[model samples]
Target: MKCVKTQDAVGHVLCHDITQIIKDVKKGTAFRKGHIVTEEDIPVLLSLGKDNLYIWEKTEGILHENEAAEYLRDICMNENMIQSEVKEGKIELIAEIDGLLKIDVDKLRAVNSLGEMMIATRHTNTTVKKGDKLVGTRIIPLLIEQEKMEKAKEVAGDRPILSLIPFKKKKVGIVTTGNEVFYGRIKDTFGPVVAEKVKEFGADVIGQTIVNDDIEKITKAVEEFIEQGADMVLCTGGMSVDPDDKTPGAIKNTGARIVSYGAPVLPGAMMLLAYYEKDGRELPIVGLPGCVMYAKRTVFDLVLPRLMADDMVTSDDLAGLGLGGLCLSCDICTFPNCGFGKGV
Candidate 1:
């Protein structure tokens, strides 16, 4: 201990070795394993470089370096733990990973919890194809005691899905119909929404044409988009059974196979899906109804992700959305997190 002479009333301040203070922070014994600590521990822990401590002061649980690292490792290997990040000595993670990505994320939680000095990949989703690579892990210096960061080293191994294989993005053609908007009677809003939606999947709108309610004209427009290299054609408006509604007929005249004439999706229930194939080359076309105009989230919200992933949307995919597709006109729509993955 060293004496301090700074304070006027105090003759000397005792200086002490702070190594034990650091050791206490390194081990949860500083507080209880799950016990919270008071502010008094702060000055003491700071005396020895414990900046990386996880402090759950409210729960009386303070996880230091090693324990915190172990908790993270546990999170990776334990499917039931949920996907959470350790912050301030508390583990905060998602309760589930439903449709988080193209690959099943539950596979990431299948490894055994073991702190290793090296690295290894425990789960590859088993179905890895020729070009699939599952995990990539590494180590970095955390500047604490060598033992404290050991658990962090184990987590360094990747929780990555199957290796990234490049596939040509789906090419889309957008056909905007409606005589009123075509002749400048009203503004064109569907095209922008459709364009923005497709762009999120890295798909390009190669060709866009505005045509009247004539079936033949709209049919020609669809053929022209195909000639311009469209793998998918999205026709907006004229989906209902009205006399002026010609988009469905135009799509039928193109000789494309109609996958589903009508879906159980509200607002967009009148939507249509068709496909045309010649010599093994197939083109998928979707006819969105006018209700897709202002409806925030509908069946379109459910299908877009699968479409972007280039996964074929069967009637089954359409069926799943029916239960979750009901659009509740919320006063404050939180999209994405709110059932509809529409925010994407």
Candidate 2:
């Protein structure tokens, strides 16, 4: 790029976007890249504080900022995502579907480590809606060596750094386990809470059973739900250390592979996660602790979106959630938007 005085810039192509800002009024590009400067535009350019303007000069082995931004976008965007028009040497990637956002963090970091370029993304592995901004990419300078962007692309590999996995409609079975509720001593609040949460993901509660804190009964209920075409099973209550709590044992008795029996998260430490496989089909079973009924968000909220997207949860995944597991319990709950379990 070459710099030329605004008064003498007539007929020269702009190398970068010229921005204009009026306090509390507006802020935007006054002259876009490739705009040929003319006599009438000289006054407007001077008003924006541009005494000199950058004019495009093709240099071998170098690329303009706008071209560098497009290269970054090409490396980051994946399925169900769209890119915004380049502005001021920056591009934003937006979600094209309501789904879970997944970012390949290692690759992202590798690409960002390349000098003079950047790719910033929203929190990964979280639910997002169509049109939500997922990522932004830009070149720090007006011109960059073409080799730098090529190295970034190599670091990013063939797979795009960002992806949106659409949620699958699921048939869910709920098993509420507590003797007091089963015996009619108290209302079954746990069942309703679990049902509502499942509905939020657009999954249906095909059936629910109120069972006493009996390991045998809980096991039977899970099996029955799977037989009835339920793809997922939720067992609420009876997951604590108390002698009456037997939900975890019941899940194990169903022959499911227990992914985890406890989590590091507050309000959900006693939760259990398991997966059952039979006849080439797999089902996820969760033993929710009592805190799920009172806490606005818990481990369940952290893991549910992945399950809905058919992403398997493992013991290592749960272990990695400890760093951001404690909820602040703010006056106004903004769960999923808050950092309750995004440690990894």
Give TM per candidate: 0.55, 0.90
Worst 10 residues of 2 by lDDT: 335-344
Task: Report the number of the highest-lDDT candidate.
Answer: 2
Instruction: Report lDDT (CA) for all predictions.
Output: 0.57, 0.89
**Tens-digit lDDT track of model 2 for 245-303:** 98888899999999989999987998899999968967899999888998888888998
Model 1 regions lying over 4 Å from their true place: 1-168, 341-344
- For model 2, name the residue pairs that clash: none
- Report the alpha-carbon TM-score of model 1 versus the true structure: 0.55
Model 1: lDDT to the true structure:
0.57
What TM-score does candidate 2 reach? 0.90
